[model samples]
Target chain A: MTELTEIKKQDLLYQGKAKEMYTTNDPDILWVHYMDQVTALNGKKKVQMKDKGKTNCAISARLFTELREQGIVSHFIEQLSPTDQLVQKVQIIPLETVVRNYASGSFVKRYQTEYLQKFDQPVIEFFYKSDELDDPFLNDDDALALGAATREQMAQIRQLALKANQHLRQIFAKMNVLLVDFKLEFGLTAAGDVILADELSPDNCRLVDLDTKQSLDKDVFRKGLGEMVPVYEEILQRLLKEGER
Target chain B: MTELTEIKKQDLLYQGKAKEMYTTNDPDILWVHYMDQVTALNGKKKVQMKDKGKTNCAISARLFTELREQGIVSHFIEQLSPTDQLVQKVQIIPLETVVRNYASGSFVKRYQTEYLQKFDQPVIEFFYKSDELDDPFLNDDDALALGAATREQMAQIRQLALKANQHLRQIFAKMNVLLVDFKLEFGLTAAGDVILADELSPDNCRLVDLDTKQSLDKDVFRKGLGEMVPVYEEILQRLLKEGER
Candidate 1:
């Protein structure tokens, strides 16, 4: 990938709750630094922890590589360091695509459904990603009305997201983790192809241990279950076993 | 329409917050009695007002007839009395289909947009009709996951709802009322054709006068504006002027 050793991280492009994005010497590349931080409630509550960034960095890189091997296009290029990576820069769509295999998080809160209730079919939802608007849950029509994406783009995102889900569930299942649900951010390439973007980590997924039923994701931070990074590392350790197949 | 004189209302089928349904002699027909009661917050608030039912009955019948003339198939058959009508009994789909020309009500609450921001195009949303679940807002996928509607039925519902909105907006415009938004319900006929069901009235529509921008619908009761019945009567008077055209 584009002489990875020669790439230089430049100016900071963005600083999100858990990651920092930087422009790179290569115009099409972005440098992402996973931070030793975690957040819940849309960054209302945040904390710093050791090894969080490295664990996430390894997991995201491995997963993106695995997904790419399965022919799912993403922005991820390659991992540069324990907590840094290079990815293709894309115009981020302002909609968050969520795929749910079982009920958890907001799904349980909104519908009062039983926790871990397996859906007969995966349920997909969209949310306008505006912190000012608290990322209000929306439908495809709302996405179009907001100019977040077009009908064809949404259809494309749906196809890509479902494919990602099928592959991801298999990966997690091999780790003995139930992928309850996950949030995805899509972006348009310069040529206008919708592709998966943003970091894939426990920060955006609700994962549960199949046997212990313990949460191995950010819910540890959100629900105050206990130490957070250890669980994420558990995920990283498991993924290392299920590493880039 | 069956002979209104010979039809007999038998067993009470269902009692809703604002209306009651009864089995009729004709197997294909159901008797609807619009109650004087008005409830908000999903029936958590309740009140009875004089002429509320009759005004709604007249308005719903007139609008339904107008839509039928425009070739939009609906369950409405004929008016029976000031507060009653005959409607074809189809299995009601448990989803609230909402169409919005301008944002108001929950749209404002959810996204915090301006109270009456006109949309580039009508925005459609669906809410799962469940009191036990507080009628959670859902997308097409969620509806399918809930077994609320089939894919084909939802597509047909969207088409019919949009057409109804087109004609309803025109009817309201003639009366100088801004058709901000409204909710609809659809049912499946025995033949499995999706058709519009449920009464259309100020109770389900947000209407505002063009000149004064005054609320002419249930917001009177909801926002404690003033006497709710007189405002509904004002709408009836205006619709009567735009009658049968």
Candidate 2:
């Protein structure tokens, strides 16, 4: 691995619930530091798990690289450290794009249905990201009325999300994990091209063991079921083993 | 209104929260009996207003006539009585189509915004009409995933909803009333045609005075502002005058 002795991390650009951003020496890149901290219910619940950041970084790096190989573009540049990465700096859109391959989480609650209702196709939802208002779910009209995204951008976002769902679900299926649902965020580069920009790991995805239906993602912590570090580590190990093949 | 001396109301087919349905002697027609009961928040808040049935029937008949004149087909046949109407019976779709010309009521609560946010274009939303589950908002994907409506049917529903919004907004504007938003329902005929059903009145619409911004619809009862009879009467009077012209 190359040492990051030349690049410097300057002023803190922003701090999120589970990550920190810093200005970097390269004008086109930003330093992303994944934190061990995790939050749920819009920060009502919080916890710190050892090695969480390292595990997530590893998974995100591998997935983003794999997605690129699959013809889906992202903002990932390269991993600088175990918990830090240098990514192409883009203006993050104020939306959380969600894709549900199966009925779970808020989908079940909203529809008042039983768990894991398999959908014939993936359902894409866009939520306006405002923690103050608990991130209200939005449709295309709501998005346009609020000036969150244009019609063309929304169409692109939906297409990209469905593509990612197909690729990621297959990848997890190979490891005997069911990629139930996940949230995504997109950003616009300086040239106004929308590309995937957020981390893709257990923190943002719901993964269930195919045989046991046990939660292997953040749902464990969110539901107060068990330790998240071991499950996250398990995910990382699975991905790494696949990479070796 | 035509007298119903020859027609006979047969078996009670169904009873909704605000209306009752009865089979008619014509076999192809159904008798819609509007009730005075007004419900909101999924029937959690309700009250019986005197003359509500008669007023709503008059308003719905006039509006339906106006919409038909504007080239929108519906099931409305003719007014049989002040509180009853003859309509074509069809299998009702389990979805409520909503068109919003301005942000109000649940829209404001969903987005956490103040009321009366005018839209340059009307927004259309679909809700699965289930009283047990409070009729959750749905998109085209959700509707298809739940087997609620086919893609072709949803496309038609959306187009018809937008068309209805355009026609209704213009009609209300002519009466010095701002048609904020309204709900609609569509049903398939025995011959498999989707036509508009359900009453359009103060209960199902949010109408504001163009000059005073006064609550002229069910918000009068829902928000405990004042009596609703006078405002409904005002609406019916205005429409009747427009009809005479």
Candidate 3:
């Protein structure tokens, strides 16, 4: 077991799967250790998905760079190493924000209607906490009833999610891939300014080849399609090769 | 094809499959036609799960009655008929809010983690519009970036979501059913007050027999476990039977 000692030496705060988060003396600065360990199924089933940590760090760093180039603010300051990231430590808002541009996953399972036929309009959803219960889809009333967010804040979140989705979609389109969907996190400063938090990596998104429909994200493991890590590496190699050109 | 026809004498708004919403000229009250059209997978794959809509209505009515009895504020005014609901018309919010108490669905898929472990803390999530992209989980920054909510409002939503979860969990525990997870929605009144909105039906929740592990919600369809509607009916019957005792 990778104890918290190594992280504590650097003033660790929280230890989440794949990353040991540390708070620097400066409240705004954070150091995250992209550990070698990999977790699946919410840490219930831990498998040493070899090199996953390094791969995620590299991919995330690259994606963050791309996002920044496109004017999307993210926490990624720089790649400290293949397995570390230096970031801004904002107070993370406890919400997993998602935006979608295509039809897939629970949406397919929920409505099972034709509404998903290349829906030009984006839709938003909110899920309250209790990961052990698994995150369930919620509506606005439920949100208010549960006090997960206020009506006004939810409106703001929706706009932000939509903007992020649009920006990422444009970037991926240029790369000949469709940014199907992605997860984002946000944090607040003590002063109450919300900033984009969390890592933007292949692990948190779904990327499909425009021509062949090949996935370049962690959906392979999720769907049990097989050999996902290699597929991810291949996608990175392809991106690198294209960059060289 | 359910087409909307205005009964010239009566004003009505044919809202989606689940409800036919209408209002009296007075505008203080609202009538909803709780239809029997139970759609799964957005109506792409239809299963004639008989008595599903009625069961959901009954289940929702019964659950709301219990919630009211417990002094939980909810939108349910009264059950007009087996398939219709009478409610107070308020400004509706177009967001789906979800809260989970146990692990299930995409959480299992995305995290590829355990099914039903208790979390040290509840984890709230948000998704932007469009289920076709399958409700993508989101964070606060994404929420704000999309402009769906404000900073203070998001905080309030979190508190509300947590409170609702606690209330529901307590109620279900007394009923000897585990409130595994459920969806909720909220709306604001003309006076800028947030109130619980929507029907709390079996369709929107996952309930299981405390002893037998028989599912009481719509997870059957999502998981393709088979005969989901009947399973829902069975659960209702069980609840009814318990009430008789």
Q: Which candidate leads in TM-score? A: 2
**lDDT for B155 (candidate 3):** 70
Rank candidates by DockQ, best first: 1, 2, 3
State what share of the real interface contacts each candidate retains: 1.00, 0.61, 0.00
Write the residue-wise lDDT of candidate 1 on A1-245 in tens digits: 45778999999999998899999888889999999998888889989899999999998998888999999999998888899999999999998999999989888888777899899888889999998888999998878876889999898988988999999999999999999999999999898888999978998899999999999999988989999988998899888867655
Docking class of 3: incorrect
The models' CA-based lDDT, in order, is 0.91, 0.89, 0.67
DockQ category of candidate 2: medium
Q: TM-score each candidate.
A: 0.96, 0.97, 0.52
Candidates 1 and 2 compared: the better one by lDDT is 1
Q: Which regions of candidate 1 are displaced past 4 Å?
A: A1-3, B1-4
Error of 2 at B60 (Å): 0.4
Give one digit per residue, the lDDT tens place, for model 2 in A32-81. 99999999999999888889999999999999999999999999988999
- What lDDT does candidate 3 reach at residue B34? 67
Per-residue C-alpha lDDT of model 3 across residues A49-97, encoded as one tens digit per residue = 7777888888778777766776667778777778788787786655677
Q: In candidate 2 chain B, where is summed lDDT lowest over 10 consecutive residues?
A: B1-10
Q: Give the TM-score of candidate 1.
A: 0.96
